[model samples]
Target: MSTVTTRTVAYPADGLTMIGHLALPAGDDRRPAVLVGPEGPGLNDFQRGRAESLAELGYVALAFDINGGRWFTDPGEMLARVTPLLADPDRMRDIGHAALDVLLAEPRTDPDRIAAVGYGTGGAIALELGRDGVDLRAIGTVNALTTGRPGEAARIRCPVWAGVGSEDPIMPPAQREAFTAEIEAAGVDWRLVVYGGALHAFHHPPVDQAVVPGVGYHPRHARRAWRDVVDLLDECVPVPG
Candidate 1:
C-alpha cells in the first residue's frame, strides 16, 4: 500500500474562511487530482477520509470545505444553510472555484488531469463547476440530481456521472429525468446510476445527529458509489507514470 499524507488547508470563499483537507500519495511524481465536496452538513471525517483513500489510489485529493468548516447536527440547520446556496449557482461556483484553486496550487497535483466529485449540495456544486466550463476531466455527483440554468450544460467539456437513490424524495425520478434530459440536449457525456432501495444521502455513513426525513445511510450503496467514482477517475483522468 502506498503511504498517504493529509493536511488541513485554509482558504477564502463565499466571504468566509474555508478550511479544506488535502491528501497526497507517497512519491515525488505529480499525479492526477480529485476535488471532493461534502454534503450540506459540511466537511466531516467521512469526506476527509475520502481524500486520503483517493491518495491511496495514486491521486492527490482535496476535500473542500463549505459553510466555513461548520458542520450541522440538526437537519433543519443543514437545510437552512444549504437551501439558499442551492438557489444560487454563482455562489456555488465561487465556493467550488476556490477549492479548485487550492487543488491546482498543490505541487503534487497534475493540473491537466483533474476531476470533481461531490455529495448532496456539494454534488450540485460540482455540476455547476462543469456548467461554468471549468477544464475538468470528469465530474461525479451523488444525491444531487439538480439541474442548472437552461442551456448552461453545453459549456461542459467533460463527462459527468451522477448517482442517486431510487427512492430519494429529495431527488425523485422526475428530477433525475430532467437532469438527464438537460445534459443530453447539451450533448454532454453523462451517466446516472440509481441504487435500489436507497434514500437521499445513502452514500453517507451513519450520523449521530438527526437527519432529514428522506435521508438514510446505505453502507452497500455507499461503497458501490465510491467504486463508481473511482472508476470514473480511472477512465477519464489517469495518472501518468
Candidate 2:
C-alpha cells in the first residue's frame, strides 16, 4: 500500500458550504480518482476513511459532503434532509457535480479515469450522476436502489454495481425490480448484489445513535461488500502502475 495524505476542502454546493475530505496517494503524479458519497446521515468519519483507503490503493479520492459539514444522529433530522433531496434528481446532480468539480480540481486527479462510489442516500447521488450523463469509469452504490426518471439511465456511460441487503424493506423486491427494469431498458451495464440476511445499510458499521427502522449492521457482509466495491473499481478504474 502506498502512503496517503488527507485534507479538508470547503466548497459551495447548492447554496450550502460543503466541506469535503480529499485523500491523495503519495507522490505528485496524477492518478485515477474516485468520489465517495456518504450515507443519508451525511458526511462523517466513515466516508473520510473510505477516501483514505482508496488513496492507499494509489487513487485520488474525495469524500464529498451532503449536509454541509454537519452529520445527523437523529433519525428524523436525517430523513427531513435526505427525503426531499432524494425526490429531486436535479438537485442531487448539482451536489454531485459540485463534488466532481472539487475532485477534478486537484492536480493529482486523473479526471478522465474517475469513478463514483456511494452509500445509502449518497448511493442515489451516484446514480443520479450516471443518469445525468457524467463520463465516469464506474458507478458503485451500496443500498439506495432508488430508480431514476424514465430513459435517463441511458446517459450512463459506464457499468453500475449496486449492493443491498436481502431483507431491506426500504429497498424491497418490488423497488429493486423497478430499478433494474429501468436500467435494463436503458441498455446500461448493471449488476445487483443482495447480501443474504442483511438489512438496509448493511454495509455500514453499527452506530451508537438512534437510526431509522429496518437498518442493522452485518459485520461479515460489510467486509464482503467492501471487497466487491474494490473489485469493481479494480476492473473499471485500476490505479496506475
Candidate 3:
C-alpha cells in the first residue's frame, strides 16, 4: 500500500456542516478520484479506512459524512434519519454533490476520472448522483439496491454495479428484480452480484455498538465486495502509467 495522507474537510449540506474525510495517495500528479459514502449509521472509522485504502491504490478518495459527524449506534435513531433521507432523492443528491465538491477541490483529484462507491444509504446517495445526471465513470454500491424514480434512471451516464447478500431481507429477490427492471428498461449498463448465504450489510465489519436486525458481517464477502468495487474502478477509470 502507498503512503496515504488524510485530512478532515468541512462542508455544508442539508442545513448542516458535514465533516468529511479526504484521503490522498503519495503523489503530486492528479489521479482518478472516488467518493466513498458510509452506511446509515454515519461516516465512521470503517468508511474512513476505505478512503485511505483507495488512496493507497493510487486514487484520490473522499469518505464523506452525513449527520454532521454523528455515528448513530441506535438502530431506531439511524432509521429515523435514514428512512426519510432515502425517500427524498433530491436531498440525497444534495448530500452527494456536496461531498463530490469536496473531493473535486483536492489538487490530486482528476475531475475527468471519477467514481462513487457507497454502502447502504450511502449507496443510495451515489445512485441519486447518477440519477441526477452526474458524469461519473462508474457507480458501485453494496447492500444498496435502490431504484430510481420513474424515468429518472435515464439520466445516469455511466455503468452501475451493485452487490447484495442473497438472503438480505431488506433487499429481497423481488426488490432486486424491481431495481434491475427499472434500470434495464432505461437502457443502463448495470450488474448485480449477490453473495450467497450472506445477510444484509455483508460488506461491513461487525460493530460492537448495536445489532441492527437483518444485518450481519461476512468477512469473506466483505473482502470480495471491496475487490469487486476496485475492479469496477480499474475497468472504468484506469490510473495513468
Candidate 4:
C-alpha cells in the first residue's frame, strides 16, 4: 500500500478562516482530488475518514468545512445558518467554489479530475456545485434533496450519483421521483440508488444513530454504498500518469 498523509489547511473564505482536513497519497504523482462537504455545519470525524479513504484509493482528498466550525441542530439555529444557504443558490455556489479553488491549488492534486461528495446538508452543496458548472468529473451525494430552485438541474455539467434510503421519511418516494425527472430533463447523466431497508445516514455505519437523532443505518447498504462510491471515483477520477 502507498503511504498516506493527512494535514490541516486553513483557507480564506468570506473573510474568515475555513479549516479543512486534506489527505493525499505520498508519492510524486499528482493525483485527482475530491472535495468533501459535511452534512450539517462543521467538519466531523466521518468526513475526515472519507478523505483518508479517498487518499488510500490514490487520490488527494480534501474535506472542507463549509460551516466554519459553527453547527446547530436546533431548529432555530438550523434555519438561521443552514436553511438560508439551502434556500439561496448563490451562497452555496460561492462556498463550493472557494473550496474547489483551495483544493485545485494543492500541488499534489489534479485539478481536471476533481470531484465532490457530500452528506445530507453537504450533499445539497455538492449538488449545487455540479449545477453551477464545476466541470467536475462526477458528483456524489448521500441523503440530500433537490436544492436552489427546482430548475437549477439544467445547469449540471457532470454525471451525478445520489444514494438514498428507501425508508428515509425526509426523502420520500415522490420527492425522489421529482428529483429524477428534473435531472433527466436537464440531459445530464445521473443515477439514484435506493438502498432497501435502510434509513438516512447509512454510509456511516458506526454513526448511524449517534450523530443524528432520527437516522439508523443498514449494514448491508452501508457496505454497498462505500463500494459504489469507490467505484465511481475509480471510473471518473483515474490515477494520474
Best lDDT goes to which candidate?
Answer: 1
Candidates' lDDT values, in order? 0.93, 0.93, 0.93, 0.80
TM-score of 3: 0.98
The predicted structure with the larger lDDT, 2 or 4, is 2
Over 42-87, each residue of candidate 4 has an lDDT whose tens digit, in order, gives 5777778889988887889989877776555554565567776777
| lDDT of model 1, residue 209 | 91
Off by over 4 Å in 2: none
Ten contiguous residues minimizing lDDT sum, candidate 1: 204-213
Model 1 lDDT per residue over 1-241, tens place: 4499999999999999999999999998899999999999999999899999999989999999999989999878988999999999999999999999999999998989999999998899999999999999999999998899999999999999999999999999999999999999999999999999999999888878985788899999989999999999989998765
For every candidate in turn, the CA RMSD to the true structure comes to 1.1, 1.1, 1.0, 2.5
Clashing pairs in 4: none
* Candidate 1 vs. true structure, TM-score: 0.98
lDDT of 2 by residue, 188-231 (tens): 89999999999998887877679667999999999999999999
Clashes (backbone N, CA, C under 3 Å), per candidate, total 0, 0, 0, 0
Better structure of 1 and 3 per lDDT: 1
Candidate 2 positional error at 152, Å: 0.6
lDDT of 3 by residue, 1-241 (tens): 4589999999999998999999998869999999999999999888899999998889999999978899998999989989999999999999999999998888888999999999999999999999999999999999899987899999999999999999899999998999999999989999999999999988888886788678899999989999999999999988886
